[model samples]
Target: MFEKLSYLQLQQYWWFLVGTLAALFVFMTFVQGGQTLLRELGRSETQRDLLVNALGRKWELGFTSLVMFGGALFAAFPLFYSVSFGGAYFVWMAILFCFIIQAVAYEYRKKPDNFLGQRTYEIFLFINGSLGIFLVGAALATLFSGGHFVVNEMHLSRWTNPLYGLEALANPFNIAFGLMLFFLSRLLASLFFINEIDDEAIYARARKSLLRCTLMFLAAFAYVAYAIATMKGYGYDPATGAVFAKEGKYLQNLLAMPAVAGMLLAGVLGLLAGVAMTLWGGSRRGIWPAGIGVVLVVLALFLTLGYNDTAFYPSLSDPQSSLTIQNSSGSRYTLVAMSYVSLMVPFVLGYIAFVWRAMSAKRLTVEEVENDPHHY
Candidate 1:
């Protein structure tokens, strides 16, 4: 069945798969968000250990999803992978460093005679939770806000700015998106803790944190969404396949793709409902709805960026260098081969879900961690 589609169809199919993985990666960032709250929610060493172990169990899942997201991009859209990862070296390097520290921290945090000490490792997790997530959001924002790079006839790319994409910090819109993700992650983390941990104190603190993070997330999300709606976005000419600037381009895309718009709406409402149920109704299951909501919202945004002849990655240095799926995709044979491989994704996800369920079958407790010989 997969053999029958046109090249463009395959490109779009892979783009959709990439977008889905990206959305799942963002959702998995609840692990990062939970990292930031370890000290705040866990007042005692035992409590802190509980939080750490709970998060450590799932941290590798987030890391795995991240690796998958990058691998998919590299395989399906090598040009974009090269242009952004190569040209924006500093930003990507910083992100990589943060994750590296995170891996080290998780591995050695509870190890005997560790050189760095537990506090230092905890600080590293904080850096990953805050700085790492923020950098990711800002980097993604450049997809819409455009990046400082030029692509040559050979499809080689060069960074125009000296900061090597660190300049994205200068744009408030990018920062806004970063802040939004940071708080959203925190909110999701709070909900997850409420569901997964059996401690009453942690639940109380998570509830309070959820309220605060929700407010902060709403503020940043509103600003970013409004800006995108009002801002001039990159457009593509279907006949000529050229990139150009169009006012209210994103807003128009939402209108043009009503189904995408509906997804966004449903996602926002789902998020709000999840928060409300947790804050008022005292529902521990808020994470389920809220997590799915985040995925949907992020997926809609990605679809808007890539579908409808939109330039998913725009080049500020050269509009003509903007990348659409058609321009940035791998050859048809590669995509077809990858599509066959993509069939394994569902089974992989199902296995992950099974493992997650088995691991989380019982709520985590201080006694359990104390009894277990090995703990993060």
Candidate 2:
């Protein structure tokens, strides 16, 4: 079935797949968000244990999804994988270190022979949760705001600036998106805690914090959206396929693609519904709506960045060097073969859902954690 499609069609299809994976990954970051809130929500050891165990059930899902997203990107768009990962080694290394520490923290936090002690590992987990998600979001922001990198004739990319990807900090738009993701993840975490952990103090604190974080999230999201809507965007010539800067390019893309606009609207409404229900409706299941919303919103955002003759990865030093889905994707044979393999993704997701349901058969409580023989 994949044999008949053109190379451009395959590239677009893979972008859709990548966008979906990224959206799911963002939603899963709620595990990190909950980690960041461990102390803020927990008043005692029992409450903390409850929170940790609740988050532990889903932490691996986030990590696994991240790996899959990267893997899929590497297979479908090797040039983007090489350019971004090869050039932004420092930032990627830091992000990887954060996740590695999180893995260690989870495994050893309750182990008897753990050398670092529980508190130290918990601290490391908190750091990993906060910084890791924020940095990843910031890195994605570079797709629009541009990054400092150059590609040679052999398509090998090098970091043009000494700071590597850290130079992205200089872009306010990128920072805005980063902060937005941080607060959004935190908000989702709070919602998840309210549903998963059965603690009055934690629920109340998370409820209050969710309200505060949601407001901040909206503010940051608005700023980034506004900037993207009005700012200059990279456009490619249909004849020469050469990239060029065009004012209000993103705005045009949105107008040109009504389906993306509908998705964005739906995502926004879903987010608002989740937040409002969590705050006012005495609902413990706000995570469901909000989590879905995160996926939809993030997917739409990625689509906007890559589709409609836009440059998904732009170059600051040379605008012409920007990479689009067409320029960066792999050969048609590779994309077709990978597309066939992609059919297994739904089965994986189904298995994950089954595991999630089994683990969350009942809400987490202090008594359960204390009385249970096996605890996180």
Candidate 3:
């Protein structure tokens, strides 16, 4: 069944898979967001412990999802993996360091003979939650805002900027996108706490923080929306397949693909509905819808960047060198063979669900953390 499709169809299918995995990774960032809330939402030592243990139950999922997303890109779109990871080694190294410290913090924080102390580990988690997530957002922002890399006829790429990927931080739009993602993670984390902790104190604090998180998220969302609507976007001639810049190209893409536009609108509404359900309707399952909303919104944005003959990775230094799905994807045989493997994705997702349900079968509490021998 997978062998008969044209090369473009296989490319689209694999790109869709990549986008789906990316969305899941973004949704799982709630764990990172919750890490930042350890001190802010937890008033006492016991409360902090509760937050830690609850988040600890799931942090691996987020980290693992991120790794899977990267791996998928590496396999399905090796050129992008090479160009971005190779050219932007500094930023990737920083992100890798942050996550490494996070794993260390969780493992060593509760160990009896740890010399660094718990506070140091907590700080490490905060850095991973904040700076690590921010850098990811800034890096992704280059998809829409464009990067400073150039590719030659031989398909080799180089970062024209000396700072490598760190230069993305210099772009105001990237900064705003990073901030937006950071706050969204926190917002999702708060909702997760409200639903899963079953402690009134933590619930109250988490609920209270939602207002500020919503406001901050909305402010950043507004800026990003405006920027996307107005910025000159990278595109290619569908007829000629030549990359170039065009004003309001994102808007054009959205309009050209109404289904994507619908997804974006539905995603926005789902997010708003989740917040409303928590704040006014008094629901505990806001995170479910909110998480789904994050996935859809992110997926829609990714589609807008990649589809409609648009360049998913634009090159500001050399416009024609931009990376598009047509140019950067794996070979036809590679994609067809991998498409068969992609069928296993459903079972993988089901297994993830099973493990998640098993791990979270019982709501976390101080008593549970106190008694559990393996609590983080």
Candidate 4:
């Protein structure tokens, strides 16, 4: 079946897979969002333990999603992986450092007499939740906003700015998207806590936090939506392989692809419905709807950037260096091999769902954390 399709088909297929993994990673960031609320939602040590353990059960999944996202990109679009990850080393390094601390914090937060102390570890989780997510959003924004890098004939890439990818911070659109993701994560986390934790105080606080985070998320999301709709996007000519800027490119993409626009609408409505259910209907199952909405929304965003002959990774330093799915993809042979490997994805997701269900079958309580020997 794989051998039957053209190379472009395979490239698009892998790009879709990469986008799906990225969407899942964004949804999983509810873990990061939950981390930021540990102090706000959990007022006591026992309550904090409940939050920590609840999140710890799923933090690794978010991290794994991130790794898989990177790996898929590296395999399917090595040029993009090298250009973005290599040229923007500082930003990527900071993100890596944040996740490293997150893993360490989760492992040793409850260890007997740890050297850094519990407060320090908690702080690490906060850093990962806020700074880590913000930077990732900014990094992804470069896909639309363009980055300061040049690619040579030999395919070598160099960063034009001294700040590396940190220059993305200068763009308000980037910051808006970053904050949007951060708050969305928080909102999802609150819904998750409401569903996963059996404590009254945590549930009440999570409900309130959901409202606040929803407002913040809406503000940031509105700004990003406006920016993307109005901004000039990099356009690629499939016939000549030329790159140029087109006004209202993203909005046009939405108009051109009604199915994707429908997805965006459905995702937004689902997200709003999830929040409303949690806020007014007192539904604990809000996380499921909200999480699925997040994945759909993110997947739609990625499709917008990659489809419509748009340059998914644009180079500000050299317009010709902009990367489209065709230019940045691996060889056809590699993609075919990877496509076969991709068949395992459904089974892997099913197994993860099974494990997640088994683990979450019982809600976390003060008693479980105090009694369980394996508690984080």
Candidate 5:
């Protein structure tokens, strides 16, 4: 069926798949968010262990989804992957280090006589949750704000700064975007705890933290939204393939793509409604709506960037060096082969859903965790 589609169509299809993976990964980051909640919700050793075990159950899933997201993007758009991964070494390296330590923490946190104590490993999880998520958000913001990279005629890319991707930290808008995702992750983690844990004290503390996180999430979102709404965006001419900065380009994309605009609006409202249901309506299932909202919002944002002739990875060092789906995609033969493999995605998702249901069949309890021989 994909044989009939044009090269551009195949690129769009792969980008859609990549974007979906990314959106799901964002939702899966509740694991990272929950990592940050180990201390706040868990007041004692057992309590902390309960929280750790709870997050541990799903950390591998989050990590797996993240790897898949990156892999899909790399397969679909090798240029974007090479440019960002090569040029943004510092940011990506720090994120990679955070994930490595996270793996170490979960594996050895409870091991007896491990040179570093459990608390040290716990700190590792915290860094992965906070700094890691923040940097991921900042890295994503570069898609909209553009990066300081130039691509030669041979298509090799180079970073324009000594700090490499660490320079993203210098942008206030990037920082706000990072903070937004960081707090959003924490908020989602709280909602997840409210849904997953059976302890009353943990639930109360989770709710308490949720309220503050919600406020912080909204504040950071406000700043990022304002910046996006006000910022000039990169666009390319379909005929000539030259990139240019247009005033309010992102806003124009939203206006031009009404369906995406609707998704964005629905996503915002759904996210807020989920918080209301938990905080006011006494609903434990807020994670469902909130998680779905995160996927929709992120998916819509990604669509806005990759669709409508916009530059998904704009270049500030050289305007024409911007990477779009069209310019950065792999050859048609590669995309077609990948497209066939992508058909198995639905079956994989079905397996994940089955496992998720089996795992969460009952709320996690301290007693259960204490008795389980395999508890993290």
Candidate 6:
């Protein structure tokens, strides 16, 4: 059935798959967000343990989805993998380190007589929660904002800035997006806590955090939206396969394609609505609506970056090095093969859903953490 479609169809399919996985990963980062706020949310040792255990129950899902997201992007679009991964090594390394520490911190934080004290491990978790999500979001922002790398004639990439991946900080717009992710993660964390943690103190604090983070999220998001919509964008000449700068390209893309525009608007509204409902209604189940809203918004953002012949990853050092979905994707045969494997994605998602349901079937309380034999 898939063989009948053209190669371009396969590439688009893979892009969509990658986008979907990315959306899922973003939603899962709520675990990281919640971890970052452990100190603020928990006043007592028992309460802290409760928060850690609640977050611990699902941190692996975020990590696994992140790894899978990278792998899928590598298989589907080798050039982006090579260019971004190669050029942005510093930022990538930092994110990797953060995640590694997260896994270790969770495993040994509660272990008896661990070399590092529990406080130290908890700090590590906070680092992962804040810096990990922020840096990753910034790195992704480079997809639309371009980066400091030049691709040689042979397609070898060279970093133009001495700061390496950290150069992304120089772009205010990128930082804006990064801040948006950080705050959004925190917001989601609050919603999750409201649903998962039953302690009144923690629940009230989570609500407050959600409200504050939502404000920050909106501020950063508005900045990014304004910048992206008005800024000059990298456009590819599909006929020549050459990339060049075009003014208001993103806005044009939104205007030219009604479906994409509709998705963008819907995603934004969904995200806002979710946050509002959680904040105003004192809803315990805000996580569901907010989580789904994040997925939609992120998916729409990714589609805007990749579709419409835009350079998803533009090279600031050399214009010719810019990469579009058409040029950076793997060979048609490889894409087709991967497309077949993608069929199992539903099963994987189903398994994750089942695990999530079983885990969250009962709300987590301090008493449960103290009494449960399987406490993390």
Residues 68-153, candidate 5, lDDT per residue (tens digit)? 99999889899999999999999999999989999999999988899999899999999999999999999989998888899888
Steric clashes per prediction: 0, 0, 0, 0, 0, 0
Which sequence of candidate numbers ranks them by lDDT, best first? 1, 4, 5, 3, 2, 6
Which structure among the candidates has the greatest lDDT?
1
Which of 3 and 6 is the better model by TM-score? 3
- Put down candidate 2 lDDT per residue, 10-62, tens digits, no spaces: 89999999999999999998999889998998878788888889988899999
List the lowest-lDDT window of 10 residues for candidate 4. 148-157
Kindly report which residue pairs in candidate 5 clash with one another: none
- Give lDDT tens digits, candidate 6, residues 1-376: 6788787778778888899999999999999899889888998899889999999899999999999999999999988898888878899999999999999998888888999999999999999999999999999899888988887767677888887889898889889988989998999898889898888999888889988999888889889989998998899988898888999988888887788788777777777777787789767888887788788778887888888888888888887888888888988889878888999999999999999999999999878898987677
Measure candidate 3: CA RMSD: 1.0
Native-vs-model 6 lDDT?
0.87
lDDT of 4: 0.93
Candidates' TM-scores? 0.99, 0.98, 0.98, 0.99, 0.99, 0.97
Please identify model 6 stretches exceeding 4 Å from their true place.
none
lDDT of 1: 0.94
Candidate 3, residue 62: lDDT: 90
The local distance difference test score of each candidate is: 0.94, 0.89, 0.90, 0.93, 0.92, 0.87
Runs in model 1 lying further than 4 Å from the true structure: none
Instruction: In model 6, state the lDDT of residue 132.
Output: 92
CA displacement after TM-score superposition, residue 173 of candidate 2 (Å): 1.5
Winner by lDDT between candidate 6 and candidate 1: 1
Residue pairs clashing in model 4 are none
Name the regions of candidate 2 deviating beyond 4 angstroms.
Answer: none
- The sequence of per-residue lDDT tens digits that candidate 1 reaches over residues 1-376 is 7789999899989989998999999999999999999989999999999999999889999999999999999999999999999999999999999999999998899899998899999999999999999999999999989998899889888999999999999999999999999999999999999999999999999999999999999999999999999998888886787898999999999999999999999989888888999999978999988888999999999999999889999999999999999999999999999999999999999999999999999999999999988999
For model 2, what is the alpha-carbon lDDT of residue 66?
Answer: 95
Scanning candidate 2 in windows of ten residues, the lowest lDDT window is: 150-159
Error of 3 at 248 (Å): 0.7
| Residue 146 error, candidate 5, Å | 1.2
